[model samples]
Target: MKYIVFFIGLTVVLLFFFSSCSDSNSDHENKTEPGIQHESMKAKTVGIDFAGHDFFQPVSNSISHIHGIGYPNNQEALFIATHHGLKVYSNGIWYETKEHNHDYMGFQATSEGFYSSGHPEEGSTLLNPLGLLKSEDFGKTIEKVSFYGESDFHHMSASYYTPSIYVVNTVPNSKLGTGLYYSLDGGEVWMQSELEGLPQASAHSLATHPRLAKIVGISTPEGLFLSHNNGNTFSLISEERSIGTFFIKDESILYVTADGEESLLEQSLESDDTKQIPLPTLSEGDSILYLAVNPLHEQEISFGTVAGDVWRTEDYGDSWSNILEKGNVP
Candidate 1:
């Protein structure tokens, strides 16, 4: 009787587990709501409410420049990297991570986890300039992969096609010989990348192609540069837009934002024609700070501004939905 009871209980638990997983998986797909807190925009949680979860609240009312934006492996939430820490928006709610309040400079979200290079939070003895740090458990804890105390990468990016990582090492690591470091083995090993024809080694922003690891697009003070032979050589693509920052959503499409420009330029690698689309001006003199495209949903794109305002467009820039604004937390 005891054995039969145990078997029955186990079977019931398994059935419940499977049922819950199936329901959860379907929930995200069925969610038709476009933006966060679509029904109630004025709802605000009380002070310091988030705990025992992967969420926190930004202490400041306004936000700094959004360094990076990405969705994790599950694509259930969008992660925003600001000067404060990692902020996640999911299921019509805004959540912030309490752990590791470091200023992530070179932030990138991958299916594996979050990778960054930045300064450590106050009261922590980790390092002033953290190089190649990763957090697999959603910004709860970060571990150093390489160049812990020696270097900082202001512009760093990882490729989705292959295990390739690139960074413009601002601080030279004596062992690594800095300028541009490339890691083919997922940050396990690093070496100096060949930047033969590039006018400027420093980059304001850099992006690796989604389909080819060899292809890279860099934005500098001079202009935008494209590399086809895996950073061995680079050719100047355009100097007309005064490209301040750029990101490659895929092998063909490169989204760019120029300095002091209000329009977002969507440039195609296959064609010389580019579309200059104006972003929604949430506040006065608002320009796009960073842009990110969902790997799972290629058409879905998200961009934020220095004023802590975020917007999303799901239909290839046909329309947009405001996610959140400064001083307003959902």
Candidate 2:
């Protein structure tokens, strides 16, 4: 009887110990294991959390990471490139693209269509890293123009005068990866430019003159450089001003934003004078990350923020309206 009682007690103790161990293991798995959540997140339009949000009608996640912005011709919409996919805000209605939610790295919507390069979406059998892609129907379908698996452009700009012309900063391990590349007949043919006379050795952003065929402005780490004779050579315009992005508003004025400045600076190309355009109503801690001025209407401009917000000004930053709030992308 003593032996039987002792064995029963030992069995109970062992059972209790195993049960506690199992519960601990289960808890750890629940905390660390990604399971379906990780896989679901890979899809741009899957498993999204859209709760208690008044602005977001069909979006699952908040717009946090904005890469680029484009305004295609004949469309009354603004295509915004985000981490998830391309979003369109048209006619006061916000919509997220349904298919081909690939990551668009360098996006520019010209009169022709949308041009970009980046990685493809999850579960896609297409090229992992999309080289140069062109979408004629806005940001709906992408077709390989050139560099199918060769390069990914992070900084791309199109000439306003010529729709097929583009200037891009190429990725490494590609054919045109040495320096600045300029394409007159689209991405079909590329010419590696020497970018002579630039004081700074490196290039950041680039913009072509709206009317001039060969004139282009390049933003470097040091300052802004202007190339009057195509891209064969350049001349430093401003030494003290650190240019982040610049847009050629006609041939007389250049809209510029510095590295850490809040207000927009309008620099006269003829007089070489600078003036500040104030954005007084911007939310606290929100600064301009990107600027887009309408080619047809210079006064109508939109600026995007690093915090996923967008503001528009019809009078060139004098008065502003927050189109997309800081956390609400509608």
Q: Which lDDT tens digits does candidate 1 get at residues 18-85?
A: 00111101111112211111121121222223433534654344455466787754354678876677
**Clashing residue pairs, backbone N/CA/C < 3 A, model 2:** none
lDDT of 2 by residue, 1-330 (tens): 000000011011111110011010011111211110111111122222323222234555566567677565524456678666777665555667666777776677665566787766777765545667776655544566666555656666676547444445423344454455667776667776666676534444567776664777776566777877667788877655556666765655444445564446777677677778777556666655566776555677776776668877778767877778874854
lDDT of 1: 0.61
lDDT of each: 0.61, 0.58
In angstroms, the error of model 2 at 123 is 1.3
Backbone N/Cα/C clashes per model:
2, 0
TM, every model:
0.75, 0.75
Report how far off residue 314 is in candidate 1 (Å). 2.0
